[model samples]
Target: MMQATQKQDFTTTFSVDRNPREAFEAITNVRGWWSQEVEGVTDQVGGEFDHHYKDVHRCRIRVTELVPGRKVAWLVLDNFFNFIEDQAEWKGTEVVFEISEKDGGAEVRFTHVGLVPQYECYDVCTNAWNGYLGGSLRNLINTGQGQPNPKEGGNAPAHQDAATVLRARRTP
Candidate 1:
């Protein structure tokens, strides 16, 4: 398995008119703004989320920590069948989003922390985060809603159908 001894982190900031609590709540409602490409519960700490990006690229994320209106973090439990096949390659890896009140608005910061920089999927994964956390987040905050699909973004490519390759995992 590949390991990144040095931590890898990417951050992007966004400002919104809503208070921190509302902004943070919208973010935690993953199914609302995120691609339906992902599914499962995310309302509280310990809930799990699954993101299916391609026929073979799938990630199982577990909500590890949460502070309402402040922060949320997820542990990558499984990343299977794509660039990185070994689950251990991503285990313990965490992605976090922190929200706080700012002048006239709320501020959001997203981080994909320590994802084994040398691994094959680093770039792609980072780009995906940009779309979800950066693009989708901005849309949700400004409009008080979210884009239903990726194609809604002029820059985004058409989404691939995943009904055949991905299905909701029975919640354990």
Candidate 2:
């Protein structure tokens, strides 16, 4: 007998003083909170964009669904993570954002479908999302600008090969 696999998407939700429309707009402005190294379009349905985190990670995302002032979803066409055994783990995954009215304000819910805890990059990836969705993205909804990753250089360590990253992860 085969057991069914449990769903383990990573999700984060936050409330903002803004309205649903404002929250929806902020979510579509991916570069404002996701990464400044993004390329191509992001605010329209059927649009495609590429997000890069230096040489560490890169993903091609296509907007698959959009509902004004309500929801948005992106399909991951391709993905590459220099630090993971399965570089394309995020491929075919869906990144979704749901907006609704709550407490006379807006409530935003972000989910990364197919990002199960069983994946090797789950912890690191989810932690990063916590910062992006829960912190940076949330800030963007409240303010005009977001605290995105440094554009050129910052305290981030230089990129390392996959083997090196694996070794570092295993180290005490």
Candidate 3:
């Protein structure tokens, strides 16, 4: 029997007292909210950056679209999630942030394209993103400095290769 596949992407929207430009700037500052371990440029189109979350997650993303005070999009070039069955599940995803003026403030919408519910990491990833976007990122837009994840270094043991952690997951 053929079953219909459902499409589900994580999205969150909120309005802030700041202007669209401020919201845009905050979204571009990936390290400020998403991760402190980001490397490379993230503010310009075609620029690339790497985000590492301890040893559990790592991804290289390129800024594919950036419209000042309006929209920004990132293409995930490569990814590895140690806890997931498909370590490279997020490799081709797109993370998008759109900002618009509304009610004398800025309305920000964030979407993680391809992060469907069928993916193994969807629940955990979505919850983490809620804290990052709704809580941390929003705090940065309202006040200075976001509550980013602590720099706790890598989680893999010193004797093990980081890539090996992905292969060590139990088979279903």
Candidate 4:
């Protein structure tokens, strides 16, 4: 049997109001803006992280490294959400975020490594990441809290899940 392969890598940059350290901490606080659809506990290096979507799907995330305001990386262990069971797919797969000060504001760069573009979930995952990192992240930095989700009776899609809930699905 031929092995299925999927990989995607991309970097997105955004400006933030807080300092590098402050900005970094907020981004690492995954539970804050990831939506109640996902649950996880991550505070330090080598900590365990989990993403839950109600009872439908759960993804395991492990913090592989942390470097203060400079960088943070996590590897996916199991993705019940995507339903691809290759453990190797999770190996070396990391979501890394970098923070730095630029032009009186913080610059944040989000990178997802080891995600094969061929995977069906690649587009969704990348789009979701962009919304959370670029949208909610910027809001939090400037407003001290994320904007409410429009679908959940708020004014806008401040988080990734909220945006997905509002976006039209494409038939494959």
Candidate 5:
């Protein structure tokens, strides 16, 4: 087990005024808040999807788990990064999302299970995530609109359709 003081996987949580079901719906709609460039199936377990941010990053995702209004998770089947030495750093990682009721609203907790501080992408990834979840995802749940990547002709690595991201195991 990991000690409390030890560094943990990337995690962030945000609250929305909407109910749990609304939060769930907004989250499952990947194209609404993440990016319009997303391709493939979302909102179902065992679905496959692909997301790319121009050519800087691309990944194939397999939806491994989902629980309506409660949780969702994804397994990274393949990964590529133009700026990283480890082209497969995200391969096999699991992305997880958890939803719970709070103050009559909903709170979404996101975790990238394998994205630890030691990895090169940690800082950049976490920063982007803060913006996506705290800003875009939150807005989507609240106002029915989100600032997802606008079919970028290649911008910061966003728009992958994994629904929920929870990094899994790291391979050397």
Candidate 6:
């Protein structure tokens, strides 16, 4: 059996026992599940936001698409990762969230549109996204409380799932 191997973007999906509107709202609440410091606008189209996690990873995201109860997309304008050699690996990528009605509830699909396995950040990033989407984000939609990184001094490095990435990399 010849198995075809092809690289694909990183993506994850989860179902919530809520309406599409609720799921969409939870997805827009970036500060809720992503667990970082966000500045500027996140829910408005054409808006820009910057999120940083203890100098480990920082990115400027511009909201390129916002569809109520349907979808939201953000384009990565700039990115910095202290762990990987290519600090700009996330630049020019797109973070997209799609919400659709399913089984009397809603399903949210998250896709990091250019984050292929070829990038160094793929493994660590995939783990983080899985935690964010499957655990935190899903909790927020269901219970109204997402375990976000608080502003107070706790949870060092901010990114709950990716803190080790910083210490694992060598500083040149």
Best by lDDT: 6
The sequence of per-residue lDDT tens digits that candidate 4 reaches over residues 1-172 is 1122343366678988788888877777675556544445676777887676543246788887787888777887766543333435444567778778888878988777776576555665677677777777677766667542323333335334532443334323
Model 5 RMSD in angstroms: 6.9
Question: What do the candidate models score in CA lDDT, each in turn?
Answer: 0.67, 0.81, 0.80, 0.64, 0.79, 0.82
- Clash pairs for candidate 5: 93-168, 94-166, 94-167, 94-168, 95-165, 95-166, 96-165, 96-166, 113-167, 114-167
Candidate 4 ranges beyond 4 A from true positions: 1-8, 37-40, 55-57, 82-92, 147-172
Cα deviation at 74, candidate 4, in Å, is: 0.8
TM per prediction: 0.75, 0.87, 0.84, 0.73, 0.84, 0.89
- Where model 1 places Cα greater than 4 Å from the true spot, the runs are 1-6, 84-88, 148-172
Question: Residues 52-159, candidate 1, lDDT per residue (tens digit)?
Answer: 644546778999888888888888887774444454666667878888899968898877676646765555556656666656667787777776444223333322
Give the worst 10-residue stretch by lDDT in candidate 6.
Answer: 156-165
Which of the two, 1 or 3, has more lDDT? 3
Off by over 4 Å in 3: 1-6, 153-172
lDDT (Cα, tens digit) per residue for candidate 5, span 1-172: 2223355888888899999899989988888888788899888999999887765568898888888888888998998865567766788888888999999999998988787898877765777778888888899999999988878664433433222232222322
Order of models, best TM-score first: 6, 2, 5, 3, 1, 4
lDDT of 4 at 123: 60
The residue-by-residue lDDT of candidate 6 on 96-161, one tens digit each, is: 888999999999988898899999888878877787788888999999988766664766433354
Off by over 4 Å in 2: 1-5, 154-167, 170-172
As for candidate 3, its clashing pairs are none
User: Which scores better on lDDT, 1 or 5?
Assistant: 5
